[model samples]
Target: MPVDAPMPGSYGVRIPPWLAAEQATLPARITDRTERMRMVNRIAARNVEEGTGGPFAALVLDSDTGDVVSAGVNLVLSANVASAHAEVVALSLAQTRVGDWNLGTDPARPRALVGNAQPCVMCLGTLIWSGVKALDFSVPGFEVERITGFDEGPVPADWREQLEKRGIAVDTGLLQEECSTVLEDFRSRVAAGTITLYNGG
Candidate 1:
């Protein structure tokens, strides 16, 4: 749902091993990063259009030894509702090179469903369908289930059952107040570091 902060260098927290291995081929590059990412993005979108419903992130392999060069998450938003914004952004990045990109990961509740809800159910559902695992800090009003902890680990009973029934889980106590700022900083760090991929413009 709402992608949360996972251990920065840990590769297995949110992203699956198979996918990561697949993406490892593309070396992180700056020269044509944006354009290449966009091309891969179109492919992911096509997957969604074909009823795959993928906000799928693709890794651009080096084409020779299969080293991961870059990755990009696609299909930022589906329903056009303001509530789904964060999930879209997170998915966008996660599908890219920043493997475990956290989308806030903090426990949150929206005052109204209008333009504030984090990890909207629909958007989350789309992510789950794409086979991506996300760590949410807290999930409230959850009659179905609940999750616990900020890192990847065991979850609550209710949540386990819910996941068994429906392909999703929500954790509690993973909430943090500085999620947005941290997310911004993380992005800035990546963008700054990869300026060459964006052509150092």
Candidate 2:
């Protein structure tokens, strides 16, 4: 496995686990702060019913063999995920982003810049929902720098500044720079040698 790649069966959390739980159960009936939360939960529920696990994962069709390369959640179990709306958003994001293919429709095509950007929101929401015990977004890897507001520092300095600037009191512990799991896909690519290694030790 590439040293920089995430370990097998690990997924990082970009947000708080409890907060994600909150987002998972957003009130569908009330029209207020929980609207987005409700949407996320709905998506999760549908993912379970449909038997399409990895609501946070995306499929990448290998241009060479038409094989599917999955990144993010391995399977989006409906039981694990409890919202239909959230499933829509997550699946949509995965289809549109992640993996070697950049085009949402064609997984074989590789558009590193745009395609890589697709997993941001889903990843964030998943980590929250999964109760990610740890996480690490710092360090430049796999187009990580291209993310506008992400950083490798101990704290999400950029996210903090933006929230504070907007007068939003950021109270989530998930924001702190802590090491955590990154799902099994990260290791699968390495064992398969799909992800290339560069730079120096």
Candidate 3:
């Protein structure tokens, strides 16, 4: 038998062309912190009950205006590809909308990222490369591994320190109980063998 099978079909993320235009016209900032956090959390929660990618969601926001530019959920298992991660999808869409891919730069008003769980290494690297100055997450990485039974890969003990060094500010522990519930649901599904986390075995 062949060692590997061909990918069944195309899998990726794409936002409509009009989205970028829409984002450009958004008001230049949101003053309400609670409103902004709630928006991110609500979107994150939506994907948990019924959406793509396990139980994670992510968003890219305009740091100055607090307007949401792009958002998506983890699509690895659903898309049968590793790049379909929530952060990957969201960042890509945000860049696509802006067309510069440098939205994360600009010391005056860099972009911001929010995710339901701490980003995996691939996403972390993307965040650094993408130039986002601020990151907010609801769940810690260790908790994901402890509760979900999947190896989180080689994230250093000083992950936060590394980000801080790069001028990326991180906020943790928002909506803890709600985010953990999503993690619990993911573990339950994995335990029942309802989904194979990945194809490589």
Best by lDDT: 3
In TM-score terms, which candidate is top? 3
- Candidate ranking (lDDT, best to worst): 3, 1, 2
lDDT head-to-head 2 vs 3, winner: 3
Encode model 2's per-residue lDDT on 109-191: one tens digit a residue: 42111111222443434333322122222222223323222221232436435434533232222211111122133334334
lDDT (Cα, 0-100) at 129 in candidate 1: 47
Model 2 ranges off by over 4 Å: 1-157, 172-179, 193-201
lDDT of 1: 0.32
Measured on C-alpha atoms, candidate 3 has an lDDT of 0.70
Worst 10 residues of 1 by lDDT: 109-118
CA error at residue 46 for candidate 3, angstroms: 3.2
Query: How well is each residue in 1-201 modelled by candidate 3, as lDDT tens digits?
Result: 776967658545653233334345534555455555555566555554453456667778877678777766666765566777778878888888789777755677778888878887778888888878888888888887777765656778888999999988988888777778877886777678765554210
Distance from true location, Cα of 16 in model 1, Å: 27
**How does each model score on lDDT?**
0.32, 0.29, 0.70
TM-score per prediction, in order, is: 0.27, 0.22, 0.79
Candidate scoring better on TM-score of 1 and 2: 1
